[model samples]
Target: MDCLPLHTLQTVFGFHAFRPFQEEIINRLMAGDDSFVLMPTGGGKSLCYQIPALHRHGVAIVVSPLISLMKDQVDALRENGVAAAAYNSSLGERDSRQLLARLHAGELDLLYVAPERLMNDSFLERLREIPVALFAIDEAHCVSQWGHDFRPEYVALGRLRGIFPGIPLIALTATADHQTRNDIMERLGLADAQVYITGFDRPNIRYTVMEKRKPFQQLQEFLGTRPDEAGIVYALSRKRVEEVASKLRELGIEAAPYHAGLADRERSRVQEAFLRDDIRVVVATVAFGMGIDKPNVRFVVHYDLPKNIESYYQETGRAGRDGLPAEALLLFGYGDIPISRSLIESGTNPEQVRIELHKLSAMIGFAEAGSCRRGALLGYFGQRLEEPCGNCDLCLDPPDSFDATEEARKALSCVYRVGQRFGAGHVIDVLRGSKNERIRQLGHDRLSTYGIGAHLAAEAWGSIIRQLIHRGYLQQDLANFSVLKLTPSALPLLRGEERLVLAKPRIKVAEAKKEPRRRGTVLNMEYNEDLFQSLRALRKRLADEQNVPPYVIFSDATLAEMAALRPLDSEALLKVNGVGVQKLGRYGAAFLEVIRQD
Candidate 1:
């Protein structure tokens, strides 16, 4: 029993070693102690609990957030020859009854359930009669109001610690900042649990942001570079999702639209098709991608700006899960900011609105950052990167900088002259000397700074003001109609005590001087492209026959390894990273035949 975890790792899950904190986490759970894990997506978070479940007594109860995610996990576990099942709304009456019988009989190793179902009174009573192994909560950030994707149902999960006193419980999430992390601990009553924060850097992903000019054309140009690759295009509205999906189809790309507006059955079909490689792209609102477990996504393009950095980070983290090079492209348009802010302000809870507004401001700062983009992103998570990541747009193609000492003074002065009670629009208007009626009616025309910036265009002035706000020289007072107010740091610049330099605002996408490396290509070793494609086709066929996603049979990363290693016999095939005893018996022969022929 002491050696069972490593034994299970090789014979069942097929991994030779544990990732950073996996073994320690599994040990804590097995010893009947609670834990909190903050690992990135595709960082093998599930295995931390799954391995412990297989080694412990009775069935491990996993509280998942979505039905699709539950099914994907259960499917993959079952493929690995584990007795795992999901009890949810998607299950039929007979199947649900049988699953319950298995639970009562102690015949199952794991059960995935939604938080609502697990919290019901009858379910609580039933669990007391069984020998439960442990309780696991995935996406634990949903329990915190500070978390971007807060769910009211998840708040009730705090009761789990009280309900199951002796059983070990573990909570996991891919995204959380300092505030949200503490909230999750308090809300879930895991204050004494062992906390593991593996880090937030996904080095395989390249982050790029471009000003939104003819966005559809930009998306087309981006998609043109990587053909037949799996990706997701995120939009702000359902209408935009449909529009983008339609346009992509017209261009002969295999694409589909997904949003809350779509029927459940239609959404399920689209999601399944995507997992099976039937759809090359999914144009969706933020509603999609939370439940998707696809590991081969080569890219994720934000058609509109996300409202917050957590949302943006979680969405982008969905790509490059397989440890392959992927791209996260954000089309940042100034127009999207107001739409996002209006939606946030419409919330009835003032506190929640305030939190959301701050998050949005941080997100804007990331987009407007002139230095390292990755550094800015990680800084928000309270982790500092010592150097610029050479993968982001700023690090790759550096932004042009110009001394803006005079421009900064004019912008800060206009904010002061406007009584520090106006938003950026009115400030920019006064700076550019607009003769609009509101400006004249407010009698702001007489101010000395009113026409000081008249030589610059409205866009240039807008850029300067935004940079000042991001640089902490100015702050947006969300409580007071988001008016721009000068910060203490603005005094020195206004008094000619400091010089300022800013990146010339990028209004258009920069053309690459050389052809960039194709995304989703293996970086470590060169694999035979033809053999990789053949192995992929074979995996797809086997997955279709099993009525599961292709990744359930084998991930693209594993296939690439097979293509690279070119193992010709069963003994050598078992040495591949993903090939465990069960997988070796199931897939080794089929893959070997292809490798030998090639």
Candidate 2:
């Protein structure tokens, strides 16, 4: 039962410390206790298992939902000098046998497996023979029938406890409400397990819920400021993923497409490039999560609304993993909802579809909400926040409030004047008094309020429609592709029957433009970028020459400090993080000379 402090292990993993609730969970599991970890993505749940797995004696059996995720964790573990392997579909019989031999021979510390493989009679017999330390279930939320991502296999995973009665089990998921959490415990036969619930708020990620007007334009506007930052653009379909990736590439971004449709090699290449920071953005579907481990991702944009806040939180949580400031910009509209509904409904039973759709609609309401996106997000997870996060679109937009009853009445009148058959676009055109040929031919220009409301712009009418829907004055017809319909609430505005004060478009916060080429500053990049590369080579060479790991010479953290500050002396390098007097004497002069040559 000997152990190192959690903080010490965090530093060994190249991190400063555990995130909130991470240490508590780690201590629980490290004490040989069963626990359920309900943590959001980017919430440091990995460390909860990883840290304890390293400190524990026997090999940790990690039950992952996907082979991709298994490979990712194994690769990351090996990267940090830990022996880990996975027996899955990706491996041939030889590899699987080799991995099993290693595990049984006590040569490996961690092993990941798909649930079906673990359920096999032969696999279970083999696992029983091995000295299993702790049983870890990743994506534990999938066990719940109420969860959106219910996998029957996950439910079967609970039988593991019955099979291996003495093995301590730890279930983990990034996106689960209390009900799902409870379901996971009950289903996994760990109802009395220590429950660790981390707060769902990610303040580092700026929550943005924009009206889905010209989603491409919205995407471009956001990227205009952050062209160089790495990000993920989540779409609902493979076609949309390809289309958005193509469009972003056309816009001169280093973008790529990812989904189950792409070849495994191509997906692997793109994933590698994204991890290496070679690509700036990845346009993908929900298939892109779980396996992703890269930190320092600056943004995550969702072109289509996610089906639930759980999905939304997990996807957005991918950004800002390094505790740095990032943005979660999700573009959504009423049209995206039914597409999700129909997809799930057509494939599943009627009752289950109904329940899933209801959850989706509630999530959409949050997207269209004018209040704090963070507050709405936390509230959905059953966690209460005391204040609106000032970083979201609603907080930033701070729209102007006025009596929209008269305008709403005029807008609905304008829609009615045009026969109530047209969509929001055509209706907005008429409300803003546009003189297109369709308007002229339809003769809606003759309406009393048509030219009278000429002061409003089309975007303004768009804002009005968004607010109308948000206020429940307008309903989107799900039977159609979200055709705007005047609800009973709209009747007050239509006849000036009741008063309603609503905000206008908030002040546009002009974001700084992206300068990929370093517009204002000019320097010899060979000396700048190449110099940093050369320093890395020197650091590695010095480390090898001294017979120690590179960090033992000076960490990458110190190397970066030397590059950024271009420290030319030993004393200067000492000021860098991780640089100490002992190592300063060992390798400082060599690095200083590398920079001095510049």
Candidate 3:
């Protein structure tokens, strides 16, 4: 094997070793073979294509979905001393002409473009005239109809394989289930490509789902612990996004709102501010995070429930991208279910609606999961954990359990006595013996099961019903108004042949005490907090002067390592991780000065 890739990794990108399958994927690309990569969010997926772009004979064409994503990747590459540029609508006509000239002159290492532009007839004709090294499709899951964020424009990317049969192509994504994975390959015409799944576990992020009581208060309490850290709070609607941003700002938290309804310039300004650490929090709809590349986000809070597991996973994966400890707090509420169902059912495509409802049911199951949260999440993606992940809320503070066999039988029987046609709310009303008009009109009050559960509160019964649905004793037919139905598994439980135990309903979010720090990476050694902050101040000054994001100069992980090791000179500083030759030549002296003074 050629050693140039490894050499480039060390001197250019400043990495010591390959992350898991990175080296193998790069080798295959260099050998002119197509590949598919399914790695988690922070799993170094970019390097798998980036290093190959540097070594290939011609400019590598990267098909990106968002202009912001293209710009971030190009900026980071240029900071690492690579000749990269993005051809997007944001560029002026003169800049676009210059970029094309450079592309034709072979003066560029990588060229990033959107899928629509790349598939244009003129762009295809122009590419035919140049020496193209390889093509990379980022956010590849968008090509699949089954993916959470599908785009019809991405389906046109399949033509690239036929147009450039000789040049290698690679497609990559952070989230794809079994069906989405196969659909991506089939849609992208990468059926013969090498597939690499590097697992779906993000152990550094602690998962917690609160009961959504006093939601804004729960959010305030959660944010109180980490007042200075940067994070994103995702809401399902623009109105809610604005409301949350206003409320947070009223409490003196530096925050801003972002949604599609905002003006383009305003959205850009807010994004730029957040990237530069000028804003501590961004409360936004789902439209805000797909293009962000910031790495120091310490937490991600779902102010409202997401629509499906894919959306939830992708949103939460935004935190802890730097391999540091982070948190994902989800405010799970029963009210969010009807809102989400209505949104999913409004679509005209019947098949699409069915798929989305199935996904929604899975999301509800995950939220109501009694076992390890990590186990339930991974299990949805077809991976099983032999033991429980000890980092989630359930693992940290176990929920109180009780013998719920009697309650389970009661809830299941209520579903049956109602002819298994009513939804959870109506079923709960009958169980609690409500004198509502619907109960009286349907004559459900005459049934024996009507007043059997009157002694228990409606909230208690809601918890039991949700648990039954999650445990496979009940299923929801989302297409038919989310009516309750009994599965074969309910028969045994209804016959009293087996007993059940479940977690008691929790109303308030538990405050987790700070844990002792663990050794993360090899360079995650003990560091002085004061010195780290000093170095961070210096980094911010330099970043502001250069008009680039602070992480573009050096990530927080690098600063922590420098503070821990206390490198005194250029030679010593060069020994630190993430200190590439280009960066050492640029910012090494300034960082070393701060360390020496300390």
Candidate 4:
């Protein structure tokens, strides 16, 4: 039970590195201690238990929530020559027997099972017969009853140590708000465990929020700007998921829908398709994306507002997992406020529902705030920043405002003249002097200020209406899909007693600009870096031609080797890990030609 061998395991795992606090967590577990790991997504949580399992005798039991995640991790480990197996409901009785026999024989280093199966009496008996190395609970936050995703069976896991006395246990989660953290310890019986909390700051992701009128058109505008980026769009309902998926397909974006309502096999297919990059955007509900392992997703957009901030944080975390730049865009409005309130109000216990509603309200406040979105988000997570982060929508595109005492008075008067029963579009038409049939139907043409503020464009007027909602000068009637309704705060602007300054929303795209810097560890090579890129381009070309994954021809390791060695002929190239005689003869010349051009 020690980490004297962990340094070797790092190299064995094919990672030239580990994150800052990985070893600290591993060392605690190696010493037969308990631990609660709260690292963010893609923060090297798997290695904490996988490496330690190799050091101890017998198999380590890894309880995972998703069979897909289990299979992917096992496949990846086996590819790197590690022995792993999964025993879940998916396995046939025969396969389960064989897997159990293999476990008894100590043939597997790690065994992944679902929490339901882990609680089986026969499974526990089989496990006890074999010397248990350790027990790992992935997605441990689900064990907390107070947590957003509480699974009933997870409470039983806290008593596992009593069943296998002296065996170590580790709990890991990508998200645990303060309440969930406390619940995890109490429910999992890890009160004495060491806590490892990687702070919730993901500086690489620039958070942006926008208020929308026609969501479908706005979605197209957003994706059309970054067609090359891989992203996900989250809807609130299964019907909306399918609708958005269809719309994106019509717009010529490769997209798919994934929800629990889909067939299990179809769901698996979509999940696998996304992992293989066969689809660029997955329009899913909150029902999807818990244990997903896709590391290259470049952005995450919420077509509808999430129920709470913790859900928002965890789902957005799936982006930029590879430590690359990413974006999180949320489209929300006052309609989402009551939707969350209804969901919370309908829960079983009123007190619990009220508590959850409070959390949801905080999320709504963060979404609509005029301050920096990141600052509000960090503050909700108990983090404080003395200065505003210059990356959010408020900082990057500072809203433009003029002394709008007159404009505010005119807009409010238009709403009042129309009796305040209409939506934003109607309000904007009256202000912009667009006397269409709808305006005539409402008899809004007779208003005194109807054509007085025709100086502003329709888009400009839309920006004013949204900003007014955000600044509390006006409120939206959610029952009317957020129709314009003046709040008490609107009186000052109407009376010319106070200056009202509101800025137009940003309607632009960010350019893809990168600063030059050296990559992670330079191999000792003389080949031009541009030529190194050329080889990679050819590898992708060959992979597409052969209809196989690029890694099958050459791994990143092999590419780095080529960049270091810059081999001249087949003899030197054949020595690379993935370069058998077949690879050298089949695809060697194209790579060599690119290197020679350097």
Model 1 stretches with alpha carbons more than 4 Å out:
401-515, 518-523
Cα lDDT listed for each candidate: 0.88, 0.72, 0.87, 0.74
lDDT of 2 by residue, 96-127 (tens): 78888898898877889888888889989987
Better of 1 and 2 by lDDT: 1
> Model 4 reaches what TM-score against the true structure?
0.72
Off by over 4 Å in 2: 7-11, 400-598
Order of quality (lDDT): 1, 3, 4, 2
Best by TM-score: 1
- lDDT tens readout by residue for model 4, 506-585: 45323223333223223433445565566767776775675544444555446656776777877777655445544566
Q: Could you give the candidate ranking by TM-score, starting with the highest?
A: 1, 3, 4, 2
Task: List TM-score per model, in order.
Answer: 0.85, 0.71, 0.84, 0.72
Off by over 4 Å in 4: 1-6, 399-598
Q: Candidate 3: lDDT over CA atoms?
A: 0.87
Off by over 4 Å in 3: 1-3, 401-524
Q: Which ten contiguous residues of candidate 3 have the minimum total lDDT?
A: 515-524
